[model samples]
Target: MTGRLFGQGEVGSSDLIREAAKRAGAKLLEYELDAQFRCSGSDGFINWVDNTLDIRRTANVLWKREDVYEFRVMDSVQELEHAIRQKAAEGSARLVAGFCWPWSNPNGDGSLVKDVQVGTWAMPWNAKPDAGHLGAGIPKSNFWASDPGGLEQVGCVYTAQGFEFDYVGIIFGPDLRYDWEKNIWVGDKKHSFDSVVKKSGDRFVDLVKNTYRVLFTRGIKGCYVHFMDEGTRKFFQSRLE
Candidate 1:
């Protein structure tokens, strides 16, 4: 019974997952946060779970290069931005909102991306992420749980794997989308900075989708997504309709 039913990468699919988990009587879980924004769970804690732009385009600092793993810039997405902000700022729930993808390494000098943090450093960058963001495998850092409203830090399947949250907001990057003509999810290696995921060749799309799926299901109360690719967003919209 414990397996993945990862639906298509649609927009509200995470919401559906949350609903289904609730129906199943899944216990809601949250991270333990300290004043410094560091977060963790009580011993033996275990559960499975579940963006915006401008402020996002300006704030999302985690990247691989100028173009390789950059955030998709758009004209307007502040509502999505505000929802995340509201969850972190007002909701009593311990929330974490972030991006998902196959790449996001530290700058060349083993330093977190500066100027990206709206204020100070937090999750996604709090833990000393890998220096190059080029690890062949998924990142092993779990910093998202620690971030407050640090939009710059984005967590993928790698960081979100064994944890659950009260509410989770996700940024679905451009690495994966559907080919309307071909009728299959497509993984654009060009959009991926992780050499391993890019090198997956035939498995690239599956890996990407699964990565986002992990991100989507990392919340017990709710899940939200802001897709970077218009095509992917449209595909999701169609599915939701």
Candidate 2:
């Protein structure tokens, strides 16, 4: 228990952990996750960009109290997927990723995380499209079990934690949205079918924020989001602008 437990400050919802670490005399080091071209996940490859990385800021940078990332907000899912396809066809897709379930909320149009291709498994889970919370679709499995080099299939938090990629396409659904009148993000458990999220209740908002926080930070280079809720999309767009 006394041993230091280190974590990435950029993604983890570990404020308490970091505070405790500071009390324990640990020095926190910051690194920039700014999207840049890289060949491999190996330190040797990452080292090649270290000079550039050291001078940059994180892709998900916090300005004031809002989180910001240099990104392209696609007008539609089709347009978003097209961008994904381009990254893939260019060989850079080796580390490009897609996120969220085909259906983020049941009440809304049941959408799938389009794989942007056919005939090959973009990720390990692509081989099993019919696996998930319900035994019939993409399984809500752990990222550790995933094929490290895989990139085609969409990855949820469970399959993406503690991992970083060159690029990620986030499909933000209606389950989490913004209330302009209230000026606060609200979490609707009923909209989410995920067992863990549905049961969060009072803690739902925190969980939702962390969920997206974890997802958004998965990309070391950049992220593009297709928000299902126009309100939320507009809210984010306003901030980015």
Candidate 3:
């Protein structure tokens, strides 16, 4: 398990398993799985994400593997969505975002409400609970990651986790940003839409960071991203440069 990639308010189960074995007087055997299965098997891309997010310090301070694994930052969310749509034509692709928008239920007519809005661009969150009579091609929330109709909506971390796509489009929300003056990543609960994560007190920042770390690493072949915060976008761009 990638311990550092744990989601908001999540506690690793590895320790619990080890403790249970000790109490039962049984030896616990552990093996580290380091082989890369995601990001086109580019471990360097993963390391670069870890270092870039300040999740851990690693030798990969710069990402120079665009030829092997596609990574691009778009100036606008419109471009991000367009790119993802183009990739989806070739293979699997989905757009995901931080939990920074309230997920409203489907409209009375069974159409999803456009809740994820960025400037002039807007898209609905994946189907909500008991979303009855969805339009012809829209998939239910559970199948959003695998279904072709999923491209019509935006996926949150809850639905996107444990799912890998050939191409991923990520919207970096305002819940977390890089504070240029302080030289640190700041988590602002006021900008967060997740109630549980926002109330994490001192751990809010780490949880928010982990949430993005998970979102950013969901692509197997490429990741296209648009940041809601300019400072955060610049910070990531600087690392690539």
Candidate 4:
């Protein structure tokens, strides 16, 4: 599969996607975000004519925050599988887990590092379609028959909102806080600056607590968790105990 990996600022996600695609032999469908970007994630080839195609399926990777589109197209199942595997290998694979059952073996802790597919949230445990967490039918990927291997799982507090997992590894990205004095979440803010700044705004305490609760409860069997900051990590350690 191939497309113009469009994104403002630095190109981490787009670059990773492109490299992974190239490694897998998927062609890059190039088009400016401002221009009409298009592609089909199937084995059948897509012929882009200024912005037209003769394929059965086609989609646009339009971004919300930025006015950009990553024109991508896939050719074969083999290419799709390779691309997914490559995408999965985008980030760290260290299983950021919670304190629970299936993930009980501490020995397996470092096994998933190296290439982690950024799960629902920036965290790993929030990984979707996990053992028990996946709702019903598996999410349809552009390619491959199953979730690619090698990618790590990072469970986030929010995305794990109402779900459960048989075994979970939660990685607390730089996105949470706990008020030690009040025994509550200092505030609940997603990947926003308001979350880090004190007076930037009031912390969504209830939301934070509830979010953590959901993330913690996901482990029907086992869990392991990693916090991004020492402060949050200390808090999680105390709570886990």
Model 4 agreement with the true structure over 89-202: per-residue lDDT tens digits: 552121322222122111243222222222322212322232322322222111111233212233333233333333334444344565567654444344422232324444
For each candidate, the alpha-carbon lDDT, in order, equals 0.46, 0.49, 0.87, 0.34
Error of 4 at 106 (Å): 34
Q: How high is the lDDT of residue 161 in model 1?
A: 61
Model 3: per-residue Cα lDDT over 82-187, one tens digit each: 9999999999999999998998877777788899999989999999746778877889877888788899999988878877899999999999999999988999
The backbone clash count of each candidate, in order, is: 8, 12, 0, 40
The numbered model that scores best in lDDT is: 3
TM-score, structure 3 vs. true? 0.84
- Give per-model TM-scores: 0.52, 0.53, 0.84, 0.33
Model 2 ranges with Cα > 4 A deviation: 1-69, 91-152
Ranking by TM-score: 3, 2, 1, 4
lDDT comparing candidate 4 with the true structure? 0.34
Q: Judged by TM-score relative to the true structure, which candidate is superior, 1 or 2?
A: 2
Q: After superposition, how far is residue 107 of candidate 1 from its true place, in Å?
A: 6.4
Question: Residue 113 in model 1: shift from native, Å?
Answer: 0.7
Candidate 2 local lDDT, residue 226:
78
TM-score of 2: 0.53
